[model samples]
Target: MENKLMMRLVIATEAILFISLMITYVYFDLSVGFTKQSINYLDIKSTGIFSVLLFSSSFTLVQAEKNYSEGKIKKLKIWLFATIVLGSVFLFGQAKEYFKLLNNHFNISLDVFSTNFFTLTGFHAFHVIIGLILLIIVFILTLAGDFDRPNSTALSSIGMYWHFVDIVWILVFTLVYVLPYLLK
Candidate 1:
């Protein structure tokens, strides 16, 4: 019971953090004097790809949790491995997009709009990286036979975090990719 409460608290804290960041991002974006010329260099298509990959990762993670609950160790590991691979791919795609933007001089220091854009999306990327690391740790534990128990709270907690991270990325994708184009 206490563990469940603690998990809920952790989720609440994460929710607060995400909400604060979103508010800051929106405030900065609206206050900035961004002409279409300033942000024309952004590669929205690449970001869309990364967003899709990250979202798909959450589905894979859910399958992994289901396998874990069913005591299918090998299947759980495979799904977890796939989730990690997809997450890595998403990170790589984000890195490539960032490099392209940098080459085009759309860096964080360029202007207020660019700064806010990079800060928001960059933070989301950072979270994704952290989630990947956590997933790797969990994967290692699974290999060590540490998560063989049915109804493992640890596995469920990890799944919750993974799902939350993906949801956050969805919101970030909407704000960074969709909103900018629509507003312009």
Candidate 2:
């Protein structure tokens, strides 16, 4: 009970953190007044592909939880591993995007757009890295027979966090990647 409550509190704080960052992005965007060409710098299609992987991890995680409830240990492992792989690839995609921007001499110091863009997305990527680390630790614990008995709410707490991360990304993706391009 205490752990679950603590997780909820942490998630609430995280939610506020993401919301504030997003609001900052919007506030700057409104002030800067970008031209249509600005959206062209972002490769929406490529990022969308990677976003799909991150979204898919939510499903895999639910599957993992389901398998755990069903006492299907092997299947749980497979699903958890899938979630980790998807998250890793998503991070890789993020890094690739960063590299592309840097190679083009685009960076946070460039202008308001770059600064807000990097601040918002960079924080999101940092969250993803944190989630990946947590997932890895859970995997290690599962392998060590820590979750075999599953007496309490260990797995579901992490699941809540993983789902929250994915949900935040969905919002960030729509705002940063989709809406700007489409509005153009």
Please write out the lDDT profile of model 2 over residues 1-184, one tens digit for every residue.
Answer: 7778988998999999999999988887888765565567789999999999999999999999898888888888899999999999999999999999989888888777788789888988888898889889878888887767555577788888889999999999999899998788
Residue lDDT tens for model 1, 1-184: 4655676787789788888888887887677656687667777787788778888888899899899888899999999999999999999998898898888888888887788777777877887887888889989998998878876677677677778888888888787678778888
- TM per candidate: 0.91, 0.95
Q: Name model 1 segments beyond 4 Å from true.
A: 1-4
Residue 175 lDDT (model 1): 77
Cα-based RMSD of the predictions, in order?
1.7, 1.2
Top candidate on TM-score is: 2
Residue 31 displacement (Å), model 2: 1.7
- Per lDDT, the best of the predicted structures is 2
lDDT of each: 0.82, 0.88
